[model samples]
Target: MNVLLIGSGGREHALAWKLSRSPLLGQLFIWPGNPGTASLGENIPLPVDDHRAVSDLIHQKGIGMVICGPEAPLADGLMDFLADRHPDLALIGPGRSGARLESSKEFAKEFMLRHGIPTARYRSFGSREAEEAISFARSLGLPAVIKADGLAAGKGVVIAQTREETETEIRAMLEGRFGQASERLVIEEFLSGIEFSVFVLTNGDQYILLPEAKDYKRIGEGDTGPNTGGMGSVSPVPFADAALMDKVRDRIIEPTLRGLKQDGIPYRGFIFFGLIRVQGDPFVIEYNCRMGDPETESVMIRLESDLLQHCLDCHQNELNPGSVRVSSSHAATICLVSGGYPGDFEKGKKIEALPQTQPEEHIFFSGVSSKDGQLVTSGGRVFAVSCLGQDQLAALDQANRLADLIQFEGKYFRRDIGFDLK
Candidate 1:
């Protein structure tokens, strides 16, 4: 069937690549897609936020389904709009009420608390409650966590090692450091452990689990600097064995899905469980309304199923968990960013020397566009390089090789993608 894929990023590119291989697919269209996705399908220049324009295009192209790749459009109620405008059109992703789990940290905390989901303890405060928030952080002691209640493009959460840093971050968040997105703050007790991502394709009550992945969020090597959207990711996390997954399904994922059904929240799309493994048990750190970038790149690389068919099953609430398939091989994805990324950075520099892909290696573009018929950087993150191999280290090695081959004026990438695990 004809499909409309939303957003423009590496995640969308990977999904486009996989969807293009589906025999069930007739035509694929990407909204404002990048150079990478442009190769796989038609890239329409329509803005995703313009619901009317999007509906117009859907009607024109006879698009049967829309797969949302980013959180913003979903959180904006794009799915709800489509459901109302075209009742027959298959839609992926959640509406605003369900997206609240990701858009509002305070709302997510409340949901977790109400559902008995294992998560870190948190207290919400508004702009006027800066002093109260600080007092709460002080009581939590050193290494306290301060989070902006709204989406900040993955940079809203900060782990403060000292009381001074904690106070400053809390005040900054409530004082509009991130503008309206940070008008409120969620002070959470810090939990130290290895963090990973869990993706679920759900239709309110029933769901299908995707491969678990671990991503490096900090921009620097060894995870030392400020957080970026993501640095790199590896699928089939070395530490999340069967036992841990069992705990995650029972203690976290199951409860979360049940809670959503119980609360009457309309949802049908990807749920990203940002989880941390503390002392061999899983505890949720956060949630996202859609698939996580960089993680999607690696997960797609390792998936051995017809993603389009699975997406259709999920949309129709006819998914059979036994039908899902994943490759035995490991996959890794490393991001290429502008030199001054996670801060101020320049764009539009001509990109060059991208290598040809082999059998298992792939390059997916994100913040890149064709400028005067030549590829050029368009955002902080330029693209991603991914590969499959016999093992995790081998996959990382091949992905890093591809990362090195791609060239731009100020291209920067972390060489040690899976370093901590090594």
Candidate 2:
């Protein structure tokens, strides 16, 4: 079957790698793909924002399926457009109505609250309602989380430890530091605990849960500094035991699917839950309508199932959890982010020697390009070096070892990517 993959990031690279391995695949095409995907499939230069062009290409190529890898296009109703043009073509991603879980933080929080899903207490506010927001923050006390209501490319949320910091964050978000994304804010009580990412392939009724993963979001080592898209991640998270997975499905995932179904938004693709294990109980932090970045690198590394078949099953509403397969082993990924990431950072800097990996190890490129026939930095999180192992420690060791070989000016990566498992 002919397939079209979207987005340009490490996650898309990993997805391309996996999809290319499918024996059922005839031709694979990537839209605005990066250097990595260029090696695997036809990299089309069509404008990703133009849904009409994308639909035209899909029809021209007889594309059997279109997999969206990022939230932007999904949030902008790309799936809806595709469905409108060619309802028979399988589109693996949520439509705009179903994407509200990620596109609007306030809507997600309110939905969770209404449906009895476990989550942090939050209050939403517009920029003009400063006094009301301040009062809500004061009631929630210090050490609150201030989050921009719209997507801010993963830098919208700020953990404020004091009243001064909380007020400053509120001011910055309301003052347009995050552009129009911060026109509204959601202030919530801080929930301190270990966090994990859970991915589910859903057809709005039936769902198949993939292995859990833990991502390091902080840009600095030892879990300090600002949050980036993702610094690193480890898959088959040991913390998510069978009991915890059951609780997640019963108390969170199932309810969420049911809620969306009742709300007239029947989702039909990946559903990513940002979860926190607070006091031994799981609580959702946020939701991503699609796959998580570095986390996808780790998860895909440990997947023993055929990704193409699984996605087809989801599209057909025939997802059989029994047919799904995943590795019992663990996998870890370390992200090499650009210097000054999660803030202002320079791009187009020449990247030196990259690590040589055996077939056993996976190197997914993110924020990189072949400029003048030489690899150069292009995004915040540049590369995700991933390795599979029997355990988390071994995986971490392999991931770090691979990361050490890649050299470039202004390259910064967290030294403790999966240390939380230790």
Candidate 3:
């Protein structure tokens, strides 16, 4: 079937790779895709934000299915628009209303609280409540998490360790340091524990869980330094054993889907949960409506099922849990980010010594572009090197080896991506 995938990032590259391998697929197209996707299928030069243009392209091409890889367009009602324009085309993503779970943190926090989903206690505050928020933080004490209510491209949350730091964060967020994304803030109690990412493909009621993954969010090794989109990730997280996986599905995923349905927003497509394993139980840290970037690179490598078929089933609300399958092998991905990332960083720097072609080991390109026929860094996180093996250690080793082979001036990555497992 003819398929159209959206977005321009490493996650989209991985999706393209997986979908291109599906025997059910006849043709694949990626909109405004990155360099990596250009190698896999037809890279259409359609603006992601232009809804009408995208619809026209889909109709002109007779596209049968559309898979949205990122959250921005989904939150902007792309699915809703497509459904309105072409009721016959199947779209794999939540509509604008369902997207509130990711686009508005305040709404998600409140939704979780109302539905009794396991999550950190949080209080939403507007700019007028700045002083009250500071007072609330002082009451909760130090080590609080301050989050921007809206999307900020993954750089809007601050883990403040003290009252002074919390106060400063509130001021910056309210003052528009993160622009309108911080117009409202959600102060959360910091929960201590190991973090894991859980991905669920849901067709409103039925859901199929993918292998669990652990992501390194901090920019520096040893889990120190500032937060970033993601540094690296390893799949089949040891902590998410069969029992814990069941608990995640029963306690978290089920309730969330039920809640969304009760709220009149039947969610379909990928639902990502940012979870913190506190003690023996799991508490959600956040919700991402789409697949996580570097995390997807690891998870997709372990998937033994037909990626396109599963996505199509979810879109049609006919998902069969038995159809989903995953490999026993483990996978890992290390992201090579630009120098001074999660802060000020130079863009358009020339990248050299890159592998001649996409590695057979699963490499996803992120922030890169071809300028004058030369690949150059275009964003904070540039590329992801992913590998699969019998276990996490071997997978990590392969990922690191590939990472070392590619080089550019001021490129940096964490040396201890999956060290916690050791």
Best of the candidates, lDDT: 1
Q: Highest TM-score, which number? A: 1
- Per-model CA lDDT versus the true structure: 0.91, 0.89, 0.89
Writing each residue's lDDT as its tens digit, candidate 2 over 7-124 gives 9999999999999988888899999999999999999977899999999899899899999999999999999989988979988999998898999999999999988999999899
Q: Each model's RMSD to truth, in Å?
A: 1.0, 1.3, 1.5
- How do the residues 1-422 of candidate 3 rate in per-residue lDDT, one tens digit apiece? 99999988999999999999999898889999988899988898868999998999988988999999999999999999999999888888999988999999999999999899999888999988899999888877779789999999888888898778999999999888888899999998889898899998898898888878899989988999888999999998998888887788888999999999898996788999999889988899999998998899999989889988898888777788888799888898999999999899999988885664434386689999889889999989999989988888888888888888888878999989989987
- Residue 278 displacement in candidate 1 (angstroms): 0.6
Off by over 4 Å in 3: 356-360
Q: What number of clashing residue pairs does each candidate have, in the order they appear?
A: 0, 0, 0
lDDT of 2 at 414: 75
Error of 1 at 121 (Å): 1.1
For model 3 the TM-score comes to 0.97
CA-RMSD of model 2: 1.3
lDDT tens string, model 1, 1-422? 99999989999999999999999999999997888888899999877789999999999999999999998988788888888999988888898899999999999999999999989888999989988999999888879999998988887888899888988898888889899889988999889889999999988878889999999888999888888999899998989899999999999988999999899997888999999999999999999999999999999988888989988998777988887899999999999999999899999999986888897999999899897799999999898899999998899889888988899989999989888886
- Model 3 Cα displacement at 68 (Å)? 0.8
